[model samples]
Target: MLKHEKKQYKKVVLAYSGGLDTSTIVPWLKENYGCEVVCFVADVGQEREDLDGIEDKAKASGATKCIVKDLREEFVRDYVYETFKTGAIYEGDYMLGTAIARPVIAKAMVACALEEGADAIAHGATGKGNDQVRFESAVAALAPQLDVIAPWRIWDMQSREELLAYLNERNIPCKTTLKKIYSRDANVLHISTEGGELENTWNPASENVWVWTTDPLKAPDTPETVEITVEKGVVTKINGKDMTPFESISFLNEIGARHGVGRVDITENRLVGMKSRGCYETPGGTIIYKALRAIEQLVLDKNTRLYREHLAIDFAQLVYDGRWFTRLREIMMAAADEIAKDVNGKVVVRLYKGNIDVIQKDSPNSLFNFDFVTFGADQVYDQKDAEGFIRLYSLPSRIRALNEQQRKQ
Candidate 1:
């Protein structure tokens, strides 16, 4: 009798992050399958220090080759702005920082695998996390032919401590340790921290848990006001200084971070059937969310705004669940872009000790006519017309009551 043959992928491209999980997987894949591992890392405007020295680490981890691509411009201009245009805030707080980056990164990973003539693609996304859905969904949407590998699902190492020991046993160097076991995802928009003390609802985030922003108590007492300009629904100027897409985000992140802008702690439902707590720092994204929504108010009609708001919730969910590259997301984005077509404006934001307020907003497409709304006087509107409008609006209720009284008599 012939033995059941195990699946074999002679060559595979792994989405390498040089993080604890990916670090171990490179060597593990080589040891277990004897297949060649090609590592690919996409730079999506993450902190330079986090990415520094990653190439050497990938090579040290016994990868056949490592490919690093600069995707900062593409990330900012495409994914970031596209999401920003929708004014969609996930769960009313999350900026979808990690969510927004997934499709672009997955697209890059697939492209690299094809270029390298690889049979399968591998990722470090754990079975439990949203990233697994994101990476796999993008791959499925774009190129479903390639086989996908997820080590976390099949691996014997069940816990972080076990993974650490496994790496230590093999003399493989890793950046993560047991005490700080929080899983973190960082990109241009924000940084998210989960697990560890963050898992406990009553427990406050430790002093060391935060890396992106200062304590609101420690932030400056004086408020800082900044003027931001938008053209065709993209941020064009920051404090009157014209900047590229990357520059604008980087600049705003720095400015907002100093003022302790964005920090959120919430228990959210995972795409999986569990509730998870995450502490996120989205300093720059918070500012942009507020600014864009204000611009939407300035430009869009009341009903258009209301309908788009209804669309935004689904858009946020679709993004959160990693449906970015799918036809559904494409259709949603088309609708969102149409809604945001006239969302062109300048907004003055005040940042004070973690408070972000839209003090002033103006737009070329603004439908707000101050004179018409003024109680003092208005030629554009007749106040007496509201009485007639209200009576007509309640005609059904008035008619029903009159008929009931006539029947009783």
Candidate 2:
């Protein structure tokens, strides 16, 4: 298909997810490349149903062996927490659930390949999507010598139907059907749905498109309050119980989903220069984000908050563009980690029908001093000194106004 000639590889490691695309890829790689295929499944806290019997499925589809890595704690602790510290939200809504999972998955895939003595690594990401770049870029950054195989870019098959037909022709069983064709990516942080009726901008996302969260309209009328403790910008406890990073997110996800706290439908610009509409459900991530920001309101000062905001924009783009292993990412994250030092506090939030409100916040480093500005006469700040301070603050504007008046005279 593509103009490049196929080269021989002794063995190849595939980043497998037990999904339609990946299930098909396992056999396709063996047939097309004539190499031993080892499936590498990274467990980033996806639904258990999606993972059940995955090893058997991979073996039945022709993989020599399937390696499952439990990266739940690592994913939440290292990748998710670090990103949250920077407060990066892609296009203002996406919590970077899928984007953040890519590098970790790719990193594990590379290690698996190296350990398996494979000369190449493969992924099922399509050429049209951001994941293709995310997967390949991480491979390039981590292990430059290993050849990367992207079947979608090189194969003749184009549609989901074609992929199903290819698998059927070979008598390989696949669960995907024409009726249910929504492409989904899931992790502990969130689940994202695309394709099917979502391709058309006018078509509304059906109820079926949402898999994790309750419908806001159907949600309970009563509001639920959640308290979270933050240390260095990471959620360390939920309510009163201390939890690991993964446990913390899991606890919030259960509570947030019931109240329909995080559901977003947005058309985002892909790295390949195209706009794609998708619906994302990020219940736990939304709660954590709100709680962290509420704490920041108490802790960070004016200039530092502004700096973090600017850093968030760049950090978001960096993560979206798959530059995780680069020095720039390290540098930017260093700044975020620095800002996180004072982001220690507790926040109480109320979740009601898809809305989150920060009801209370407290931090040891809070800059909000009640004594500084109070209508009941505070001794901490001098009211008479405001005249001189205001004059100096507006000196440039006053000078320009005086010049204008003189010119008019």
Candidate 3:
């Protein structure tokens, strides 16, 4: 047993989710550090069952107080919508469900720690994963004076079995069983599953791995079309009903999940430099991503659209790497905001067999000129203009070919 110096801090606030790791951590912190542990639970639209009796569990595990705050509305409005506007899909597929939620939660944790006059903040994120970086980085950016105690780095408990034994010896109640052990993180945007059977890249995700979405093969044969209304790149209405950002996303999740719209199994490169296999379900997020993209196709010109595409790649990395509170993120967000000026439109998406098909798109700010695109004779555009334009466009290629001929001679 590696002994920690006792009485290092009089109080500490922990980011608790009522999970096995965090639940076990509550008691461990009190015992090892000899500090009053304050559990701060941020409800960012996770399942209600996870939050049920969480306060009781925290107190029972020796927390001085468990502060629960509902951050769902702020999460969607600020973080989720900003991500949506940036079109940040990490590694060309991930919707950033877990990554986007971290900064806001960390901010809340810092606020709670300051309010409670705690000397330290702690989290259950493992030393190997990206989350420890995420939590500590945000805390460092927000409050540098607060000490971050990462137990996984200092503790001798190497595995879940050891953790369970340590808790059992201390009479700490852990609701998790070894049989049901798989690391999972869920929020309003999506649900992610990792560890357990997902450690093998060759192994296909079993049906039991998914929680929020149905099997695409088992989905109904009939395709359902859902209309999404967007204004300045933010989703406002779904299926013709006006809704807040959280409400709209929640409703879409229900519809998209039933039809098996979004499920991806990826071996993604973690910020910690390891390739982690994770199965993610982002039914609602997928629908919103497709809809906004469809709208942008009509509203933004070629140059603006291409620029946004390039920006999305870097923006995704920033969010995934937990740099959301930095100046780089602010600059990228400003650029995205500029690009989204004309991104006002409505998109009708057909959900079927784990796919989102854009069936219709209409925007008041659309740059599509029907008369110019029509095949019939039109007064708006002259056919003779293309001959001169094509010659000028291919001038570099023609010059290159001429140079090759001269070199051959």
Candidate 4:
């Protein structure tokens, strides 16, 4: 285990969530490192219950002050929308929800630390998880001089029981209990559930694991169609009602959750070189993903679409690996933004039982022309022209076959 000398930090700004782990971290930092702890919370659209009385809880847990930043609109408009434009889905099924939110949260935490004139920034992310890397990498990129204190790596506590007991001994008021079955992270984009029954690969996720979406089997029998408008690959309006980026996601979450629009059970490769099973509910994001693909089909040409797909794969991995603050991410995002400029359209999507189908799509930049592709005869194209075109296109293949025939004889 890594060890830090006592009193190494005069004051530390912690990325506080008011969760059990972070709640315990407040006093732990003060006691172990002899530093004044300042809790910094970023409201990235987590449940209201999570934020309620968070400031009081932080102070009770030994934090000198608590700073909360309302990052909901920025999180969606900057991080979520930009990632959506790239179509970056991690490992095909995962929407990179938890991964995408980390950079934004970390950036906010760093700014808090700097503004507070703190020398170190601490996080509650455990040593085993990807969030530790995500938080530290962003901190390193944005503010290299700030020391990072990860208590999970240096502390002797191994389980939640120990953390709770430590708080109890310190007379800290923590609402967390061992009765909690799942470890969850929520943001505007999605909610992810892990641990408990999810630790076993064979065990299916119970109904209790899902917090945001309805069960597909229990969804309404009648399908609902929604009209979404896209401008430069960003969803601008839904059902012909113009909305802000944050409002759009919030509205879709309500609609998609009822229809069981997004639920993914994935055993993904973690950045720490391990496989972890988790279930994610990303209702609104799923709809936006489908909507964007529908526009791409109508507007982007074959080559540009293919290139964008390749970029998506790389961008997904970059985000998952916590390289969001790096130069590669900037370059890829720029490329994605350029391709997205042509992705303008409106799509009618049908939602039924956890499935989203694009029923109709149209765009001004569509390469699909009804006149050219019509089965009926038209003045635009000649059947005889295809014969010459095919002959020329196959000339290399014909020469290769002829050469083989002559060599065999």
Error of 3 at 297 (Å): 0.4
lDDT: the better of candidates 1 and 2: 2
**Reference-based TM-score of each model:** 0.95, 0.97, 0.97, 0.97
lDDT of 3: 0.90
- The 10 consecutive residues of candidate 3 with the worst lDDT sum are 1-10
Residue ranges of candidate 3 with Cα displaced over 4 Å: 1-7
* Model 1: how far residue 314 lies from native, Å: 0.6
Error of 4 at 96 (Å): 0.6
lDDT of each: 0.86, 0.92, 0.90, 0.91
Candidate 2 residue 7 Cα shift, in angstroms, is: 0.5
Residue pairs of candidate 3 with colliding backbone atoms: none
Q: Which runs in model 2 stand beyond 4 Å of their true positions? A: 1-3
**Candidate No. with top lDDT:** 2
Tens-place lDDT digits, model 3, residues 1-409: 4446544679999999887788778877877787999999999999999899999999988898999999999999999998899898999889999999999999999999999999999999888899999999999999999999888877787877887887788888888776664788999999999877788888888987998898999998999999999988899988789999999999999999999988999989999898999999999889999988998989888888888999999999999999998999989999999888888888999999888899999999988999999999899999999999999999999999999999999
Worst 10 residues of 2 by lDDT: 1-10
Please provide, for model 2 over 1-409, each residue's C-alpha lDDT reduced to its tens digit, 9 standing for 90 to 100.
3346888888999988877788888888887788999999999999999889999999988899999999999999999999999999998988899999999999988988999999999988888899999989999999999999998889888877888988898888888786766888899999999988999989999999999999999888999999999999999888889999999999999999999989999999999999999999999999999999999999998999999999988989999999999999999999999999999999999999999999999999999988886778877888889999999999999999999999999
Model 4 segments more than 4 A misplaced: 1-7
Please give, for residues 146-198, the per-residue lDDT of candidate 4 as tens digits: 99988888888888898899888878887777888888999888999998999
